[model samples]
Target: PDPTRAESKTVKTTCPYCGVGCGVLATLTDTPTGPQVTVKGDPDHPANKGRLCSKGSALAETLSLDGRLLHPTISGAQASWESALSQVASRFKQTIEAHGPDSVAFYVSGQLLTEDYYVANKLMKGFIGSANIDTNSRLCMASSVAGHKRAFGTDTVPGQYEDLEQADLIVLVGSNLAWCHPVLYQRIAAAKSARPAMKIINIDPRRTASSDLADLHLALTPGSDVALFNHLLTTIHEMGAVDSAFVAQHVDGFDAALSAASSGEVQATGLSANELAEFTRAWIGTEKVVTIYSQGVNQSTSGSDKVNAILNCHLATGRIGRPGMGPFSVTGQPNAMGGREVGGLANMMACHLDLENAGHRATVRDFWQAPTLPEAAGLKAVDMFRAVGDGRIKALWVMCTNPVVSMPEADRVKAAIANCDFVVVSDMYGDTDTAKLADIVLPATGWGEKTGTVTNSERCISRQRPFLPAPGTARHDWDVLAEVGRRMGWQAEFAYESPAEILREYATLSGLAAQHGKDFDISALSDLTEVEYDALPPQHWPLTKERRGGRFFADGRFFTPSGRANMLPLHHRAPAKPADATHPFILNTGRIRDQWHTMSRSGLAPRLNQHMAEPYLEIHPTDATTLGLQAADLAEVSSAHGRAILRVLLSDKVKPGAVFAPMHWTSQLSSAGRIDAVVAAEVDPVSGQPESKATPVAITKLPAR
Candidate 1:
């Protein structure tokens, strides 16, 4: 403890960037100037053994206290935690009492830990008696959740990350894994190098960097994924690739699904007959295949149907729940799966239970000792903001997310939040687009200073252990939420002191859900002591006595009441707003190689910013020429919702009539690089997930200013 002496220790934790959930070993050294941190990949972790991507490797740079929110604030004035908490609690109570519980809402995030999400869900749904709680995760994977529940009778991922490497043919539909989830891409790249016979198929509207590793790149029409997959299913049937025994015993609605597949219009996919034949032949001939999709599939008007179409082929051929095959939805955030497990979505109950089910509501209410619970689903992301805009929602609390920058129709969402009666934002930074409009801004502990659990996309539960001291007066999200709950009169239910206690409670409650035949049982860890919880390693879900860790449904047994999976009969549906003469181009928005959503943490790293310094629209060279735009030229992209001025990067990576732009820039980072402001708010009818990818847009070169 000598002054000016360097002291160092390593702490094991999980990377907070993406769903790959690579483990990190952060070494914190106290120097004369301040404490410094350096991180490396953890070799023991199964997700990515000693693999750190550009974002993960640069995590230490983002942990500084330069721009962090260190204390609570009320109406832009510095205030004590007591005053802020009391104001938030009293205002919410007043609003609910005045206009009923439906008038108050909690908009959370997938970035939150499971303990934090659990407390927020309990306080809002169990005690407050409102179902108007939703997460930004509703933007990323709600379609996958809806599709999983429709097909398997539960939100279950049937395979693990190992299946990506084990499969002979890996199909990437609407996912650019090389840039988005780099660690998993590296794993697949290594596996392909080791086994040259392993083939990759990238199906997307644009040829991304991931296509470099692909044996086939299908630049199909945007929003026509259902047609492509339906054609593949038809080929599977005609080629006699169907596992008749598996279908007869384990699947329902095969005949109807096949009939729908037979009637699908493959020409809608925008691929030649030869190309379709090649794709179908490879897919149907390969016994071991994995179809992995991401935001491109989930951020569409027909997202749920697209997901079901892919699952239809897998269920028909029995290419799922095994070592080398399945339909995998790679989540965009680190804790999206964790949010799903704790019922962070508006339409879900805790532990994969149904919100609309009376039995599920009674069980959760009784377990939490709550006075009441909602009997119906609440407003999703798109509708939630609409409610706030039109005076239906009075009080709103946004936690661990920047919806103003990330949500579809973001400009309108920003306006709604600005006009809300009461708003609270719990975040590390106070100047985010969403936080700037809050009535109360609370300081929450960030990555290196918070301890809790997160579940990865493959259902692996892992620990995020604290390695640094909490900066200033910042507190953990779960701690702040529990204090609010207690302040609002639910003292006993909100009396948790640590994240360990909250996790224990949640795990025990999962036992009740499991008894109801749910697929999210983790009761084996319910009795973990403090020491045991601190030392918990990464483990897969279904962590019970009978099944500790493995893939699901390999035995042909599903979680449905009929004990069988349902293959839905699906048809091709175009985007909500197709390109017309007024807006003659399709605007596609997604992540870049070195940035995370909104760039709150990742933007702090200079090296990461050096990779892609500013936002630029990727337009095909032919289209750029037609529009009289040059590389580095400023172009105004406008939709019916809003508009943004972006620098042009002409490339044929995109089709002639389509353009691509990264969705990471915000008002603080750039003057006019907020791309989501230009996205429309159309959502899938079933899942309520916004169509972030297929916005009809018009682009023009900006005149010199």
Candidate 2:
């Protein structure tokens, strides 16, 4: 119904889906059914100029409390908040007392807001005395984090989203930006349309929808990115694109890096020599080039090395930290960057602090007044579950993520959670794969019902303001963590009355980090009142009184201890497991245009589900013919770990020996397809992110009953 401005409320928030973090104006108005909220893109926001993708456009459909876990549950029975919080604190305390503090671990998620992540990290690492706090982001961007640290001496992204527009060339390797990050893709498409001289390169084993815009498509082998990039490094040198002055001034280990990357061939990539030569010439000739990569580059055994291989080319030519050239890792989550800022990973501390550094640890310890901080890094995601299976971790608290359907070797992950002594899950829905096995379940607020700040891929901090009322008995995830902290005896530190208070403390800690010479400093925001936080604009980071609204490394200064970036020598390494005689086809998993990871909340949206009605495996026509499989045939895909039955989708996009499947369906949503079941748990050695892209599996036609 049409109403006056005072009658209707419009609150500004950030999109909770992908890392594009587009600003949304949610207008609440009275409808016949009820007070319905309508979401529209905020034109005033810079990340996106009044543009939203299909998933973001259909967010209102997923906001209903139809399947919500409105109240806390203990052992399948509804319980009061007091009893639930006390039981959680008591069980965790018992487990830690009987075993060491490492016996209890908090496995969190990238879906969580920054405030939710900060409180969870503080409770686990500061009060509970264990570093076994890892987020689901481990499976996504951990390799990129390790690579950024190795190259920049810290985890920092040098380029902003505007770089995509200013670049003369954009190289997309192992990323399908058209579907996963459509808003950003729209921006690039608009930029290319206006310039007409801008070129795009899509490199992957399969030709996806994203390839439609590419001037050149390199359909290389599944795990051959390192070889292709190393060859690019050599090409940069051979073409005299090397910036000798910049390298000598701001980089180290040039000779060793070139020596290691000196040997590379095009044939190894399974690409024609002409194709390789064309890409190399464009990369070398373009002074303004940006290489964008995603999970496909970060989900291999050599994921870190693959990142370094890309960075090597940029660093060799000094193409980074400039207006339109650099290596950009477009993250997979809305607040994956924010999670990094709060040190949500097991190996990191808050404010981009190092977990292994004693001085940094001392700083966090002194700041939080934490008496029992772990001295070293703890188990990553895969190892954390392995420890759970082996009885090393007695109590496990999972928040906001569905690992049973999302984790590789997910059948084993489910079994491990089933065998564990105590499991607590906090989420909006109670029927998720992980929540079913949970001993205690706590209802948490959803996107439009929660208020906090989230940092996007460009280090732009935006507010996720709550415009709707919290449904039923659901509580904010951060408030739940703080109440648990109070029950566990840290009332002084976790005594935040609102998310703004937690944000203030987090910003104050960043000020402490600046004292130690860290790159992350938004301390100027520490003095924001509650009103200011509610009205917080989308501001890029490194904002301070001394230096305001500036990009990093433009003046030839780095955050490394010696003020020089390190160039690491990297070698190509094959995936941990290759396709064998029994498992002849390589199974690659990714998202479709619509559906998200495991389809927890997204599956509820009918419009989104209409895009992908069911789960199906996309196999090349040749492979389908070889296996006597036809379109609409049900096929069972199996690996050494597990099996999944899927309807067949014959496509020419994938190579002959490869098949593709969406990583959205779970047992709850579809009985025939669970992609993670067939995925191996083999992780990148440095980053511990599982190889979800290149799992070898055998496909066969499933006979009727």
Candidate 3:
């Protein structure tokens, strides 16, 4: 073949980092040194239109096979695929036989492809007769899911990414968009530059890079989002901004919700009267406004209530599901939305169906020919690890995530996994903190070597086509799940040939769910052949023949039993654990700009690591001085749960009584930088999502070594 022709081989895929779902073009060429892959933004994709963030641009550098687990292993010895699969099937079967299905659990992750998530959910919930399957998404977007279901009768995002650019005003709550979601930030920044009159409001406890573009920044008290939004709701009512006709016709619980909002004290927001007046005026004045939230909103003890408070403001003013108005949730992981569609959450069934709904459960059971299905939700992330620690869950399967480092009370989580009766970890790297404690380790293909699909934060499903070959004995996660399912004696149900076949089955089931009035309907693509599936383009959901992908609830029609949105009567609640004299400072944890979770992939790139080399703590200058600490000094931060020593970076960004730390470092990367170990295990009552942002802790400068 001609050199030019050979070098022209390129595949259009999706970024494996954030939920922005930016399209990527991976081009392969043969060089004298070896095979080289170059990745760039795909200009044809709608999500980003050729905009790539630092992490996405450095994708090619992370594909090296260094330190990769090339084959399956059992008890630190290499094992054949057949042997590993048989052992996994046998142990899981024996565990269920002895302790019932609830005794075994599958802890999956958002890094998995849609196909992988679907198979894992099916095998655990259908074949295994239990709902004990949960994804790491439980730690990020579960609050949004719970709030959506309570309000709309289903988990549905109202608007798309375009709303951010089209809106007259944008309210960002608990999100560091510039560092966490760079491409979306770039889009909003560009839109504002073009239309200078557009307004932006940043509401966060700490001043962040995203605040640079804000016309106003509200650094309110931590865990006070409900109070802030409640104040806004009452202000809208007083200003006569309520859409009376819309509320009367298409909303429920308005009287009670408004009464609750009226009772909330504006002082709880920790904002001055002038700031409150200015914020409410802009929000009530702008008819086209979008409220975007992320982990900062979701990872809280009152996360669900906080979500409803924001939704209440949008609903009261009829500013939702329209072109430039709605409450939008930006997921932290690439496939968190896809996992939601496939019932990766313990409380859900496939395609936005409720596990507690008898009719919905029956429909899925009949479609899958399942022997039995659990009628109740299972253990969530925090509870799952608790069960493991207490010996209630005997067998555990961890796939594609490092719970040992990422989970709250992580030291206990690490100890639980280490002492569990049996543990199986499926990942690309075997030496990760979690994998080191596993009884069995299964090698799996990573981003560039996997072929599947993922749904982004905006509900767009994009294909992730492979541009390189699998490194060694590694296999796709979907393939591994299917093989295990077959070994578990569900041959016919699990006899999937390819990712295309799995997508077809999932889509067909989604059609059944749509028949039951669910919001997730992608049945139009169920008839695609292998070639058609392989060449599928990025598209939005609700892809039926009559209606293609776009916004939901735009026509004032919701999936609720009463056909009206429900505005919850929410009251402001404080964080679960309050700061005391011993631990007088609250600890906030989050992600950094360059590093991804646990740094399995992003850490491999030296350029990415250069952004912020070591794990450090962000503290206010006043707090640093009060604690007898100086910049670059090592500080020991301790909570009731655990402690860590981090380099101190004194800045006024953080409040005087609060400190912030990134959650990316692990035991493998740093000796004592696993921040989650210091996070409390408190969770929201409704959503079961851990409260990661406000753990009470105490800090002191470490002595010289």
Candidate 4:
């Protein structure tokens, strides 16, 4: 090999896995034969400061040509893009004509770029005039959105990551930050090291690795968050910690909320008075408290209520808008926040806009230049699957996510997809359980091979630039969708030459939002050329130059017409279906330290496999003893929805009536290890997020053979 003509270039990009959205520097090296790309953290990005977690670091390995969907595949054969697009459009048209707009649904994902999400949302909710489009975000942070809306009158994150460092008290509620959000955890850890007096609290049922950093750990029972938060409110009020002036000026319904919080019924939520008082006292004593929460709070049947219960305490004390004092929802995916910004969720319109308001709807319709728009909120995740299963939805298009392995009542989801008249799957890998059932498979660009932007948990937007050519015949998701749109008679709007162009248009859309008073406005980049877009640096939202480092609700002005927040009164409710005598154990599902969802990428790494390589149930030793079970004992867990078998690990981490299982593995990984198979489809009424955390089940020790 010769080194005379060697060259190199660096591309700024963002991580594609978790919501930390660490900025990446992709270096392409030119050799005598060919070019090779390598990745590392971008030092200037605020989220990570040049550091990356395992998933983001190993992203390059997963973008291989092996098992890649090379072309538009229909009925197990390769086809032209034109033919595939024509078939999809014609079929969708015929299906709508035969069964109605409700007969079809678009199931998209947070992994999609804001541009892709915007177009899909427009097509399904505007052109198609069907309120049946939803995204994988429903399974992640829909509850947080609902909670923010109820408490603040808008879906807004009021603080920046710097708040985590500046806080005197940091509370990790129902989140495993150490494992799931490693980069953010590192920041908190570094902050603690720098300021030894800063206190940390971990509030969760399981004593996870994240608890290692906690000064105090509240191992509260599952579904008891509302009570604990309510008790905190009562204590704050009694201690005179309430910001009376701020509350009076910017809030309403505090009396009813306070009355409900102080009621005796709160004690029945499995928290003792003493514990609640201690937690509340700590919160009141601290001037700056940042409470971070995730799926553990959002995956419950009363998920939205739990979110408000937490936010209510912050608002009552007027702890928001100031440094180190606010409610922070740590998102599960890298672009989950971006998805919301672009109105990717089923119930929302574009640019943090509302769907129900006639004016908001009219504005978005006019912005998109759409023919028509859906008049109401769309069907959510669970409802979309229910519609498909009931035959109300004739066709379904799923992108980026694997519902068959990840959704609640996933077996039924698989069955529904299999039975649907038409099912289209767009993915990077070809062999996922969901993709196997596709009537058509469109290969999508993976992390290092795609270019776009993703917003992290803190609302920071970072660019994702391709380091190398797309593997095999895999295409960018926006290109594929746009091609299909063109075939469907949407010519000019979908005619984009590059992701850079699409991003410029998306930025312009955000600019349009600025004229309408939405805080998510990104008008600062509306003038960027293609070269500038490709070379754009990482930045946070509310991207107008005037508001850099400014968190939301700083002026105590909410998005409601009254410009005031609402303290929604909430009542505690148990899981929709509690464990019974027949199915007597509560099953909790979650992620492990070193694995990604459904083992699509993480499973490819042998080193990543060392941590809990197999699926096993973590049951209390006492429960295992009563059930004649021991560590590594084969056991069968059965629920009303389905059944699965796994090895049992008797541990004290779980309560006697409760069990825990990691949600990453699938049926392909282990014959009987798919936990979602045994999970129920119960969902929160307000958030539409499934109750994956608490499912009733029965466990029996199986014979060794």
Candidate 5:
């Protein structure tokens, strides 16, 4: 190689962290010390145009093989891949034969690639003949999926990332983009700077970094998003901002939806009259608007309704599918969208097919050549663990996720996994709380060593190509799942020779779905050869020559049976568990800027720890004083479900009666900072998403302990 070309060995991949799906160019080089790799933003990729955040910049550092589970293990001892996988397959088979198929479950994660998710969903829902497979993503974007299906007749995101830049008015609700999605936030800031006339609004309980860019910040009451958006919908009607022609042409159930919105009390949102009026004015005045939401809107008992409330405003105003328009929901995980695409949720079938619809289920079954297919929905994340604890799920396989640390009422979840008859965990690290209790552990490749595709929040699918070799005895997650499927006697169905073959099959199946008038389609790429697959570029779905830009709803046509959008009647519902005299403070849990879920990957990078070395609680000064607490004071926060001890940091950012803690810390990282231990297991009635935020708790200073 020429001297100048010595530094040019690279592979294009996707970031494994946030749903931003920023393209990364991993360059490999040789140094006297050893091999070195550096990650830079892929300049040609559309999501971030050569921009990376703090966490993405440190990804190379996080990929070290230190403390990795280099080979499969049984009860913390090394085991051959064959013996471990054989035992897993046999145990799952025996459990199903004895207790029925429903007794076995697969609790996977969004950390998995699309290929891995595809195989797992197929095995549990099609071959094994049960819908007993659910992912940690159910905790992230399930509400958005439910809301979209109820309204659009399918789970579809209409606009692209460019919509944010083109939007004249950007409304962010329950999201701290500056910390969670730094690149997209930078894009919004740049867009505002380019067009100074562009306006922004932030609607959240805490005044976060995202609020800094907002011209108006409505620090509303927690779980009151429905009230605020319903009020906005009613005001839009009053102001004649409703798209009368669009309503008459393409919308249904407007009268009932508007009536429900009219019945909601604006005061319930905890916004002053002036603040409410200002928000209404901003919405009515702006023609080009985009409303973005995140975990804050999804992690609640009424999360689905909250999602609809935001959608109702956009739908009623005829703002969707075009540039600078529509309700935009960004996901927390890199493949949450991809997981949705492949039916990783309990209630769904592959390619956006509904498990409830016999025809849709048949379409997927026929495409998979499956002998049996599940008809009804299975256990969700919270319910799955409850089943595990109750001995309903006799065999459980958890892949690429740490449910014991991340699940609501997590301590109980850990106990449930520990007592399960058979438990298998496949991950890069073997020390996770989930892995510690597994009967069998499978070593799997991590980000830089995995080859597959991931979809971002914008519905763009990008390749996560491998630039480095797999470590030790590790294998790709998809390969492991595929091998197990072969052992389970689904030889032909799981006979995937490479990730490329799996992608082709998935694409072909998607085309079959599109032929049946489903919204998911990538048939144009179904004929790609291995070379084409390796050189695949980031592309949006429902792909066709006509769908070149990958945008949907341009013609006001939806995938609904009537080809019309359905406006659901939504009402505000309070959090399932309320704060009271005993546990008066509302405990809010979320991620910090530099850490990912359970800190499995992000924790490996010591540089990421520089941001926040330890977990602490964010309490208001008043709440701190009432609890006899000071900054850095040790506090024991107890809830109805569990308790944790966290260092206290008093700040006005939190509401007087509420405090916040990051959900990233785990048992391995901290002795008692796992906030999910106390988060109630309350779930949304419709979406089945747990209310991770707003768990009622009490705090007391720990007497200088």
Candidate 6:
């Protein structure tokens, strides 16, 4: 070993944790012992110029080998890769042969790179000929996808990050950007400071720190967003702000949509007419309004309808695809957009192609050179678990996410995995709730040690390069899956020496689909060699050599059959579970400023824990008084699905009938703080996204017993 002073080098990569997609400058240094990495913000990156949030900033610290699954372990014993791969393939093959294609499933993650998502989707949908593949993103942003598909003719985000700064009015509906999307929120705050005339509106039920910056904070009732937006639509039209020419030329279904948004119908939405009038006037009066929404609007029974209602206003005013206009869905995961581009969702095929369409399926099958492709839509998040619970899915391959802790009715999900015939988990960390149930564990590389590309919420695709060698026997996720594919008898197709090679192949497939009118075409990178792919600069897609970075829908050309966006008619629907006489309080779940989902990485940082040390229920002061509970008093919140005991934080932030809980903690952190355990498994019918945000529960002061 070399005993002299170690050398250090910097590697550029994208953050793997969140959708902020901050670029990192990873510095690898050789000490007397071994190599270490120090991560800093990439000042030149467009998303977060010279800034990283707490989670992104601590990337290096989370790269250690602590509790890392180093090699394949079967039945708690070390196993050869040969044996492991063979067993996985043979068992899957046998299961499919005996029980049919739908009997097997692949549950993947948002943390995986685009190449990884592509390979997993290919294995299940292309090789296995089953659409039983779904990602953890199903839990996060599926509603946004369904909503965008209905309104935009494609699951496309119509604006760029620059629109946030350029907008005269930026309304954050059901999103806590300051905490969840820290860098983006910082950009908006800076933009507001520079332009004092700009207005900021926060429309969440909780008065979070993000609301501190809002010029108008509407602490509206829980699950009342669709109603709020529908009222705004009616008011906007009444104020004569409708762009009739644009409506006639570029959109359809407005007549029914308008009728649905009228005063009489919107009055049942629980919002005061005066408040609705003011909000509508402000939105329509401001020419450049960028309305940003997230999980709040998307994670509901009427999630798609909520999304359509918001888009209806923007479409009526012809306000989309221009500077400071359009309805933007800020994704929760870093590669959520990339996953969408690669069609990681169950109902989608590669390159924004739909699985239900025969033509799209044929094109994707031809592009992959795949012998056969799954022609029908697969089970989504909730349904996938239900299938497993019902004994229909015998084998499941879970990658990079702990659904046991994150999914609603999580305890039942854990039981379903436990009852499955075979379960394989691939992850860097070994102690996750999902990993605890695995029959085999495959070690995979993490953030600074892996290389791939990730698309952010803005659709910017940037390269994520490896700064350090793979620790222990851990390999790249795509390599592991590809190796398994080869063992499964798809040798030639799965052969790839490196991630860059896999990406090049994926790019070629995307280019072939680009000939069609899909939004995720990457024809520009079709000619890139492995070296070129590895060194590829940041670029946005629909990327052609001729056109580089730009916003979508600028020309008003949509991917729909009519080449126009659709005005989906939507009416207000209450949350699946609303506060009632028996369950007299509404429980709203969301992310806190410090931690990410499941507390896998963010929980590693002690400073991050200081924000809100543990799980506590936030209730209105009046409700606390009515329930005979005081601040810091223990209260038991129970729903039809499960129950949990949480400490109370009485505040005026919540409405009289509502309570708030952070969605990050799990049983690993606290014995009685698994919020998802208590949350009902009600999901959006169209999107399959669980309504983790709102659940009806009764709260009472805990007895001394």
Clashes of each: 0, 0, 0, 1, 0, 0
Q: Which parts of model 4 have CA positions greater than 4 angstroms off? A: 1-7, 30-37
The residue-by-residue lDDT of candidate 4 on 5-37, one tens digit each, is 879998888887889888888888897787766
Tens digits of lDDT, candidate 6, 222-266 = 667777877787777888889998888888888888887774565
How does model 5 fare in lDDT? 0.90
TM-score of each: 0.99, 0.98, 0.99, 0.97, 0.98, 0.97
Q: Which candidate would rank higher by TM-score, 2 or 6?
A: 2
Report model 3's TM-score to 2 decimal places: 0.99
**Model 2 lDDT tens row, 1-705:** 344323568998999989889999899876555687788898988888799999888887788888899899999899999999999998998888899899999999888999999999988888898989998899888999999988888898889999999999999999999999999999999999999999999998999989999999999988888889888888888888899999999999888888888866446688888999999999999999999999889988889988988988888899998999899999999999999999988999999988778899899999999987888888999999999999999999999999898899989999999999999999999999899999999999989999998888888889998888898899999999999888888889888899999988998999999877788988988898989988889998976777655457787677789988888887777778889999999999998999888777778888888887999999999999999999999999999999999989999999999999988898977885888989999998889889999999999998865
Give me the runs in candidate 3 sitting further than 4 Å from their true place: 2-6
CA lDDT for candidate 1? 0.94
Worst 10 residues of 3 by lDDT: 1-10
- As for model 5, its CA RMSD to the true structure in angstroms is 1.4
lDDT of every predicted structure (CA atoms) = 0.94, 0.90, 0.94, 0.85, 0.90, 0.85
Q: What is the Cα root-mean-square deviation between model 1 and the actual structure?
A: 0.9
lDDT of 3 by residue, 372-480 (tens): 8899999999999999999999999999999999999999999999999999999999999999999999999999999999999999999999988888899999999
What overall lDDT, based on C-alpha atoms, would model 4 receive against the true structure? 0.85
Q: What's model 5's lDDT at 335?
A: 94
Regions of candidate 1 where Cα sits further than 4 Å from its true position:
1-5
Residues 144-235 of candidate 1: C-alpha lDDT, one tens digit per residue: 99899999999999999999999999999999999999999999999999999999999999999999999999999999999999899888
RMSD of each: 0.9, 1.5, 1.0, 1.7, 1.4, 1.7
**Higher-ranked by lDDT: 2 or 3:** 3
- lDDT string for model 5 (531-636, tens) is 9989989988867645754578889998898999988787888888889999999998888899988898899899999999898999999878877888999999
